[model samples]
Target chain A: MGFFDKLKEKLTKTKQTIIEKIEAIVPVGKKIDETTIEEIEEILISSDVGIKATEQITELLKKRVKEGALKDYNDLKLLLRDELYKILEDNTSLNLSNKPSVILVVGVNGVGKTTTIGKLGHKFVSKGKSVVFAASDTFRAAAIEQLEIWANRVGADLIKHKSGADPAAVAFDALEHAKSKNKDIVIVDTAGRLHTKFPLMEELKKISRVMKKSIPESPHETLLILDATTGQNAIRQAALFNEALGLTGIVVTKLDGTAKGGVIFAVKKEIGIPIKLIGIGEGVDDLKEFNPKEFVDALFD
Target chain B: MFEALSDKLEAIFKKLKGKGILKEEDVDVALKEIRIALLEADVNFKVVKSFIDRVRQKSIGKEILESLSPAQQVIKIVYDELCELLGGSSAKIQLSPNPPTVIMMVGLHGSGKTTTSAKLARIFKKEGRRPMLVAADLQRPAAIEQLITLGKQIDVPVFHSFDLKDPRKLCQEALKKAKIDRMDPVIVDTAGRMHVDEELMQELQYVKEILNPNEVLFVADAMTGQDAVNIAKSFNDKIGIDGIILTKMDGDARGGAALSIKEVTGKPIKLIGVGEKLDALEEFYPDRIAKRILGMGDVLSLIEQAQKAFDQKEAEKLKEKIEKEDFTFDDLKEQIRKMRKMGPLENILSMLPGANKLLKDIKIDEKEFVKVEAIINSMTLEERKNPKIINASRRIRIAKGSGTTVTDVNRLIKQFNEMKKMMKKFKHGKGFKLPKIFPF
Candidate 1:
């Protein structure tokens, strides 16, 4: 089991225990009292679902029961799942509709943002798509070299600027080259941002805005890469990034290593963003599309 | 435990804290520190660049000069941002709809794939499901036997294909057996390659094609840190894995692997293996993990551990006796036995979150407990119930019987008295703190 799976497993266990307890309480259409409702809330919170989300869920459950929609525990569970699913149902696909689709990836330090971009490029190239990668994360000494190595392995074209070059300038160059080369995809690996820093978030925003000027609504997807092992903190990152850059979709990595993977449910439940891809392993082929039903099933199963 | 990282943070914060507004020069200096920190923590260089860039943009504003403690403020901002980039929220495992769900485990050799498979089996079993283990890792000699050994230890059934030549055949037969046995879940532990070998990749691909597993989990080691991300990327690109399982988390405090892999490979980490013990696997709780990284003591975890160890009935009975002010040495002996059953004293201490710093140098070995137990055992039954009976003359005799010095016996009695007094004070709503340096 991976870390994300471990996280998810804990979450699933909590979900199951709560559902089972609720099931036992509302057997055969019996009305539940305040005590039972309170117990359910405690279960949700103990499962690390966050106090706010738990309160919100219980409130929703209370409303349903009052409206006579939830006749029993089973009915309440289904309703809860549906409500949780609704919070998770923002279906933001990886803007693949664009010709030469340009995706600008961003995250904070050590969030694997650049590597995710490299993985995306590798994925596209494996599908026989023409891919070009720009080393826009130029501050670090070995970053350009690292992307170059990945590009070589995946057999994709790559562009890089001198170390310490303006990242935006590098991105502009990559887009211009991508336009002339008829590349099917131009994945610009940008500098990771500190979402807490207005200036850092602003730089990311500026990069997105600049890309739009060059490619006319370019950076078709602002994919925010998050480490699944981060648990609830991943949510804070998403909120900060979404507020600043209008993150179109999310790419959750390292799900193979964590049980907190249940955080996806909480995140999608709270953030209302679509998870485009999940990283399952270190192999190039480990990335998979976010099939919500499949995901939920794997979690419960 | 996280000394490697804390040292780096201390150095960076030390320099940053001494400054006012962060200038281009300051950014360069800070970036250098971050670059070194990430490298030391084993964060991939590519990942570090974007991270620093993001932080620089946020820290380079006039807001720094406007702040009272700009360095601390900036550090706080970076910490929060770091938390966000790791993942805004946790990713969960996707369960299959149908019964007899198949979960395929894959990873590099020595990544603890087989062990993690067994741990998952135990988890599912405790959840009241019949989980069958399929020893699909046929490449290594005794791999099947290893899985079988773990299965027997956990009391879960293992399906092996010793007669089968190919791994895919083993998986097919295993899944078939799983369905026949009515096992609600099946875990197929696949063989790992030395690196990213073609034959192993083909074998994994073949197994996936045959099993059509509900979940394909990639097991990894946290000590590898950033390299694990690249490894995940390579595996995902080839096999299309579903989730991740990181092992050896109990060993590394920096937990950079937890930070980098998710963003690098685009996978949800589902489980974490804390130790080498059979029951060491734990559900990944991000908030608790973050709190641990920040060196905040986890009180809830301590309470949970105590709950697991102390029987409620026994605890209630003991509390009643203590309430009556009838605490005895026998009770202390029972508590010591309970602690032994709870496993290593160091493990309990380390899990206390911020207790790491306090207990870092205190070596609480079994010998210490043994000495205390010997002193009590040498006492008469009446003396055991009431240590006040063991006065100087009685203590001398008891010390002779236990093969210890009279002073040793006297020290034990003194410690017991202090502990009793502290308990009494706590019961009476008085503040009673344990001595900073326990004599024993």
Candidate 2:
């Protein structure tokens, strides 16, 4: 299947929760009323669009209804599609102009950081760019081995150190290796850490510094990977990670596994970071380059 | 967006608190808000709809107590409904009379099945079960290696085959090895796959037949909102998961999956994976979860934590110090470290009434306490006992020793001194005040 079909299929549960919920609420020829608005508000919040986004959408619908813009219940679906699409328009493209443009993948452990690194490797390699994998997540015992297998599968070079090594040193070595090899892109994987942990955040900063030491403008993209299954908790993560690293983009992983796709809108609305990609399935090539229109349409359809 | 999941629930309740005897309409409004909270908490849409309907039916026009308002009645009903929806009570993994009670871990990719498998073995091992983990997750490269490495860390035996391509045969052989090794409970960490893929489900079915696992504990990410509800149904239908293990409970997530999965799949959540640490698993309690989700302080879980984390003698001493406002930097460092070890600070603070409001937006990082430890460790005994003795040069020495900038040292000292001042105020029992120590 193509990326669009795959994303649509993966988003089936999310779409059912969002679109089907609305359809169930608004019967045929039902007039828009305060109760109807309240029901919509509840649906949006439950869908994980979050409090602020739900309130905004509800308020917008109310105002538009007052203005006679939404004459029928059907109009509300179109309005929701527009509202959600507008928020998802962040990070439409990546800046791949820099040779060996480094991308740092960071999140709490088991949010698919290694898997995403592998998938991104496939994406770039498919584009015929030389990619190098950096195992900076030296704390996790299997992280290096996992990345090694992924590197081999995707035909990317890897630079790693033994587990328990200082992660920043490994990052420095990986960058230096990338420079020597003249690779087109380098993806560095950092140990997953809770953003609330200041010490771990400090560890991340040290790694970033080491990368810059090797290449002045390295790590051009610091992408925060989040599990879509999580609700508002993902927002707090985005906020802290963004505050700590000024994240350039976000990759919402496991989209196929969540009914809270509204979380995508919540992250964008809260952090204002564009979702650059979304993992639709377990396949290495299932990472879809995020298109807001397609995503919103899939939900509303 | 940064609001804690409880903050929204509390806000709706708080708005209701000021009103006099509320009408049936008021109850409807609150119930609607509660429904929204449940959904936001990641309850399934259909489940939320039915839940709200039931609560609404019970609440509307019902004669509330003279002492209690409609809001309290509604909160009680919602809390009760939440508990019921979360399987009524905690469900422990049922052990079979037969030896080698098999536990097959299943979930979608990134749902933390592998880590949870190791965590479960660690927990059972602590309980004196000769448990072993089987690496059947050959889908991801080195996944078997991952499980094995985790096994080494926790000192548990891991069964795997580097050459085995068929997961079922590998599992069968592993079961044989487990039986020979006298493993009481063999936890099989199965390959992660999408629920939509029939071939993968069949793959799980094949492993299930070979193992005939006694307990099929489905590992799920707590962050999974509505999808968790549907996924739970599919897994239950396909492989018959006995219980759900909600992973990533350490996350700031409001935990919709925990609330929704039980109602949707009719299965109890047995364990919660709070952190990535090997021992971060906790026996799931529905009442505690309901209380936390509904903005009610979870005192039961909090006391349980205090009991597990500290000795009775230590707690008594700490209590005495706090009562007397005689906290030293050493005491502060010790308490912070202990609290950090207990789990996320938010989980702890949720035990205190009204602290949820403060904790909702707060970023409580245990790592911040690590810095405090560094600063305190750098100080002299005299300085630790009497902070007034530390001069500017001494501060610089302490900062250098701690490998931190002087500014960090300064901030720590400032916060420390401020906490002291607050404790002194608090000792006088003027009022209940919570310090705004957030975003650490």
Winner by TM-score: 2
- Once superposed on the true structure, which residue ranges of model 1 sit more than 4 Å away at CA? A1-301, B14-31, B62-72, B297-307, B310-322, B333-344, B351-384, B390-414, B432-440
Q: For each of the candidates, what fraction of the native contacts does it recover?
A: 0.00, 0.60
Q: Candidate 2 falls in which docking quality class?
A: acceptable
Cα TM-score per model: 0.54, 0.83
lDDT score, candidate 1, position B278: 73
Model 2, global lDDT: 0.81
Task: Tell me how many clashing residue pairs each candidate has.
Answer: 118, 10
Q: Please provide, for model 2 over B120-174, each residue's C-alpha lDDT reduced to its tens digit, 9 standing for 90 to 100.
A: 8988898998999999888887898889999999999999889989998998898
| A191-257: candidate 2 lDDT, tens digit per residue | 8887766668888988888888989987899999988866667787899898888899999888875
Q: TM-score of B chain for each model?
A: 0.83, 0.87
Most accurate candidate by lDDT = 2
Task: Give each prediction's DockQ, rounded to 2 decimals.
Answer: 0.01, 0.43
